[model samples]
Target: MDKQKAQIWIARVLVTAVFAINVQCAIQFIAWPESYTYAYQLSGASAEAVVRGYGICFLMWNATYPPVIAAPHRYRVLFIVVIAQQLIGLVGESLLLASLGQAAGLGTLAASITRFIIFDGAGAVLLVIAFALTMRAARSLKEPAE
Candidate 1:
């Protein structure tokens, strides 16, 4: 197949993987309100408010993360940015819980770890695959006439 076509295929796969991750995130949000509250308390927000607020924040994060990583070039920068964001997010979540005047627990910790594995870890692997495929396609393109 031509390089352009391969690039298109890789883009499609990456987009689909992102959509799948988004759906998984939605399901997690729906299924894990308690977990949200556990983190939200650190922020001094009420459980109800946390549920609503985090829904928006999480969607925004998901919306932005994929395109950067999926780009054929600048992947190392994208990867580092993603890791930093995740680290910041965990810290922020913890703070949110504290500000809410709520206590933290190992259960919340477990939930956070599980959620990351289910969502970000899988997305990271898919992003790597997509990046490799995209780079391979880019390399295959013939040079244009000078």
Candidate 2:
């Protein structure tokens, strides 16, 4: 395969992996809020509702991925959007984790938030790499051939 095709494929795989992780999490949150709450050491109806709400947000956010996954070269802007979103998630979750601190009884919540921080951080890195690779490939196409 040519360099451009390889680059595009790498970007597609990375984006697909991110989408899969997010969709899996969304399904778990939406279909079984109780499981999430229990595992996260949360309790009560409010916790369940919050989990469901987050799941909805996940679904909405993931809407940006399909087009990019389908034709990343055509939908290049979505790459920027997805990368920015990942960064936002990472920063926001980091702040929440800091606020929770090592306070007593909040360990579970902090740990759960930490997991988000890790995932978002990793996702952001992956998306950035994918975006760079895709952009490089696009640029290569525009450059004069030797």
Candidate 3:
């Protein structure tokens, strides 16, 4: 496929992967809250409630992604919003890592924090790359005939 099409496909696939992750989070929180919370080493009162709430919030935000997947150009503006949201989550993840590191020390970081860094870091990287490619593709498409 051509460059523009490849760029668009990359954006769509990246967004779809994000949406799927959110869906899995929501489903897991609802169906297996305890198991899900285990990664964070959470237990006792309010752990499940917190996890479920966080998952549901992700679901709400992820609802916005499908439109972008359909038409990256039409939803090009929304891509900024998506990136911002992901970046914000990364910041929160960073804070969590710091907090966990402090609490557990370097020896045993919470599994949840580790998983977030690995998976979410990858997603963040892909989103940045997809955004750059999409922007380049849009710019090239809009240039006047050479």
Candidate 4:
């Protein structure tokens, strides 16, 4: 009803959409049949390794969602948590792809790098900026209106 509440709701909806998209991507990539070896190979990752990494990614993603829409104060902590999760995801994804590249070939490595950078990189930047905006809005909510 209030401006702060609206902002919190907007942030939550945006974050939820991002998480849902991630879940879809994970399902598409991680749940693919092992027979589709090229997908994993291109990412320079083993089928098993990508699956395991995705499990961790999903867990962290779910962990960062805020429990309620009305708590702007609580959302600040949620923003930090989400940012931390994104950092972890960036590192884990890069390492996984790099390792896969090493196991496969340079071409596979390039594909892996490209996929992560284009998709995950964009997603991470968007999520980080959204979280920053959420933090800013939350802080402003606590300040007395002039």
Find the candidate with the highest lDDT and give its number: 2
lDDT scores of the candidates, listed in order: 0.56, 0.86, 0.74, 0.61
lDDT (Cα, tens digit) per residue for candidate 2, span 10-119: 99999999999999999999999988996567789998998998999999999999888876766777778888888999999899888876789887788789899999
What lDDT tens digits, residue by residue, belong to model 1 across residues 18-124? Answer: 65666566556656666566643344345645665566566766565555535533343554455455556556555644554534555565556556545655555
TM-score of candidate 4 versus the correct structure, residues matched by position: 0.64
Candidate 4 local Cα displacement, residue 112, angstroms? 2.9
Query: If the candidates were sorted by their lDDT against the true structure, best first, what order would they fall in?
Result: 2, 3, 4, 1
| Candidate ranking (TM-score, best to worst) | 2, 3, 4, 1
Please give, for residues 1-146, the per-residue lDDT of candidate 4 as tens digits: 87766666676776666677766666654565343356445333565666556655665566555452234346566566666676776787777666665554457556755676566666677666666556667676765321
| Runs in model 1 lying further than 4 Å from the true structure | 1-4, 23-45, 65-105, 142-146
**Candidate 2 lDDT score at position 68:** 81
Model 4: how far residue 68 lies from native, Å? 7.5
Off by over 4 Å in 3: 104-109, 143-146
TM-score, each model?
0.53, 0.92, 0.82, 0.64
Better of 3 and 4 by TM-score: 3
| lDDT, model 4, position 105 | 47
Off by over 4 Å in 2: 143-146
